[model samples]
Target: MNGHALVVGEALVDIVRRAGSEPVEHVGGSPLNVALGLGRLGRAVQFVTRVGADERGTRIVEHLTAAGVALTPGSTSADRTATAQAELDEKGSARYEFDITWDPVEPPMTADVVLVHTGSIATVLEPGCDVVAELVALQSRTSTVSFDPNIRPALIADPARGRARIERLVTLADVVKASDEDLEWFAPGRDPLDTAREWLSRGPAVVAVTRGGAGAVAVCAAGTVEVPAVQVEVVDTVGAGDAFTAGLLDGLWSFGFVGIERQERLRDIGTAELRAALETAAWTSALTVARAGADLPTLAERVAARKVTR
Candidate 1:
């Protein structure tokens, strides 16, 4: 995209239970993971979330800078950084327990952004939601909007409230990514495809559903596409979904879906160009899962691996 992307959400620390009943700290949060994923994939990204002004927050900043992600500033607070405890199963899927800060500090100007990505605690948590709404309002004038309802039931004290919050977010987002779990959580008895279709009607240009291990599907009025998942050895899937969303965003950006680059200008681009970007994201995520926590690979590594595979 011609302009940069602004990723707004929480930047929490991930605590993984280690060998002896102790939790090892990691630099992760769903939004941070997405921003880092996008940044490492050669996307010009700006992180717009608040973190605690502690060592954890410093690590997040270091990690972002290392990944070449820009920051909007004035987001970090005097409070402790939000924390999450992930219990890994034998199959590498994790159950989470999070301790997140509710107070967000000051907001920043997002006038130059081409797209705004928000959801997660930015949708449900206090102050974060307000900040997200503010950013969405800015995107209405400056850029397109993308959101992922990265739903974790444990984080929502009330399911009804969570779904309602997500509904409110859907109205503002141009695109949305949700998991099967999020669908089931929102409407236990309703059909997922139907729910996604409903959300698409709610005004998002597209709605995507991620099915772990099986792959993901994107529904747009133009058409629908189902992406097959890569077969990989099991490792804790802490941020794979975020990686997937990052991949999708990368594809859309390169394709000129946002206003910064008109879609007509990219009409000549073929699926091969699009597929390469998506494939890189999936491959990087697969590599991350091969390790523990959010150990994401750089775009150069992904590109080099693609060349070898070819």
Candidate 2:
């Protein structure tokens, strides 16, 4: 919580198309959303991502600035800004068609960072994926590394290859978060909790899985604790997982579980404490789902939501 958080990944515009509604644009990407959510929570966060010199890219810059996320130098490109055409279903679930590039130059290592976060397309795509993997490896010795495999099946060409790339980062992470749907795709025919436990064995001190309406579960060396989702009227779950990741990281920081010196103790954190963190994550996601697009809740809003839930 004391040191800055470094988030490395993609920044794109989401062209959301719902029934009877014109396409709406929102600045989003897994890591970008996480950065925005952390900023809204009052964390000192820096975002390292690529955006074009286009209008969409300008919008992305404004959004991050408003959220208080510092943009890393050389975060822009001559290439056109990335865009995802998201078609929404009746239940507010989204299917995407992406038009983007993923080739980020190495970011400056100039910040006093305690936490480093990355994943999604940035971890699976070529060129940039290797750069991101190298960054995580370099930072793991000093920071609490967190990864979220916010999978987009359409973007992946080979399941086996994607799994290998994802596992590589899992090995470097202190914390790993994934949705139940992601687990199903990553390890077919295996139970989500079982897969999460397997991830813990790989290197991460903790593995947290979000189970939609059923809530979320965290698996660690100590044990597993599950927290049910907060009941709320649903909107599109656009950035729910990213918000959850931010909340989880925030909770971990609050519990003094960040940085290399304290990471070893993460596995030994009490189940009650882990549950509290999971609850925070679930509540954060609930707020995202209760709205449209990836409009994450502010810290004040999160506090008020907690009070109402209580």
Candidate 3:
């Protein structure tokens, strides 16, 4: 809680269309969701992204501001805000087509930033991806770096090139999270946990893979720990993984594992602690899925849900 979080990536509006329902617009983007989630959890958050000075950009800023997230200067300099068309199936799962630009506002290098999070399009797309990687590398010296591929196959022009960039970021990150589907696409026919272990060996202190409905498993120095999913009524799966990432980071912060000073402790975290963190993350994702769009729960809401369950 004492450490500040800096989230850098894309922020776009999702134009969601569900069959038998009208299309809806929601301000979202993977890293934006994470930033908002952390802000709602009462974490000090600073977000950097490119959004045009348009209505959609205004909505995005209002959403972040309402959640208590600060927008870094120059974040709204893009010529036009990006958009993603999310088509939802009967099962509430979504498939996306993006019209996004990867360029992001550069954040000043500061000593007080204890955690740096970046991923998705910001890590693989041209021009900005390289900047994000370099920023992550520089931040790793003084801050804890967290990453999530959140791979959108449609956005990746070359699987090989994208995989290389992702792996390189994994080596720079202290914590990494990916979905089962993402892993399947990254390494066909391979178990997600195996990939988690491999990523852990590369550099990350914690490598977590989320399996929708089934649950999530994580690998750390102590070994692997798995947690069951929290049951919730389906709404739509937008920002679920980002919620998980935010919750995971929040749990780590609460456990004193989110700063450079605690990097070694994070590396040595035990299975029991990892399990508790993952359980919280599962609850966070469950709450997001139970709601429409990327509406995440606040800390009070998450705690109250746990209380009611107990």
Candidate 4:
């Protein structure tokens, strides 16, 4: 509610294949999910992404529109919509095979944006990745910048180059969220907490690491706070992290920790405030894992869940 958010990344259709079942398609992508999640939480948000001018592309737009997310100019591509083939295990976790294109034309920026979010393959992909990084850098001076390096090792052609690109974005971000798996893939053998701390020193005010069912830990100049995961029946962990990122942003914004006016205060946020934010993120992630695909909770659902928790 402080101001609008701009989310820049890929928007793709997920073709999920379960044993003895036909492939089910769902509109998804890390950044796109974050954008939708934010919109559902009643934030004014704009999604800037690339998709084909096909049926799948129309579905993605419809999904965003239904979630109250606005599409930026030139979000549709003339190429075919990107697709990810997800093979689900008995545990409902997925292994992905992607056929996607990510060459986007930069869109015009809106004046009311106070937060800019981008990451995943869109930060390391190609010509589009550079544009995203440039936008993040430009927005860092004026708006709070959040990043999620939802690293996909299979898609990266050059690991070293990808790491460098991620590092550069980290230097410009105010908030950074990554999973334990992402840290392991990015810096094998190094402690993830150490890496998160290192990222904090590079520039980010806070670096949050999600540790699957084990829970999450966040580090900032104030110190570190850990929150245990909310127990729930596992469905598919498709957009759980993206939901967490959205919830974290919402929590921060609600606490008056966003926008140009409050960007500097992010570094010195109190431990209680940080924990509340992490708990909000945990609850949001729990909601996603409870449902199928990357389905996130609405603001009303979140409020009801909180009341139940109390």
TM-score for candidate 2, residues paired by index: 0.98
* TM-score attained by model 4: 0.98
Query: Which of the predicted structures, 3 or 4, would earn the higher TM-score when compared with the native?
Result: 3
Tell me, by TM-score, which candidate is best. Answer: 3
Candidate 1 local Cα displacement, residue 291, angstroms: 2.1
Better of 1 and 3 by TM-score: 3
- The reply for model 4, stretches above 4 Å from the true place, is none
How do all the candidates rank in terms of TM-score, highest first?
3, 4, 2, 1
- Local distance difference test values of all predictions, in order: 0.75, 0.91, 0.93, 0.91
Off-target runs (Cα >4 Å) in candidate 3 are none
TM-score per candidate, chains pooled: 0.89, 0.98, 0.99, 0.98
Give one digit per residue, the lDDT tens place, for model 3 in 1-310: 4668999899999999999889999999999999999999999999989999999999999999999999999999999999999999998899999998877767889889999999999999988999899999999999999999999999889999999999999999999999999999999999888888888999999999999989999999998898998998979999999999999999989888899989999999999999988998999999999999999999999999999999
Which candidate leads in lDDT?
3
lDDT of 4 by residue, 173-226 (tens): 999999999999888999999999999999888899999899999998989999
For candidate 3, the 10 contiguous residues with the lowest summed lDDT are 101-110
Worst 10 residues of 1 by lDDT: 260-269
Residue lDDT tens for model 1, 84-154: 98887767788888888655544566566777887787778765676677767767566777888888777
lDDT of 1: 0.75
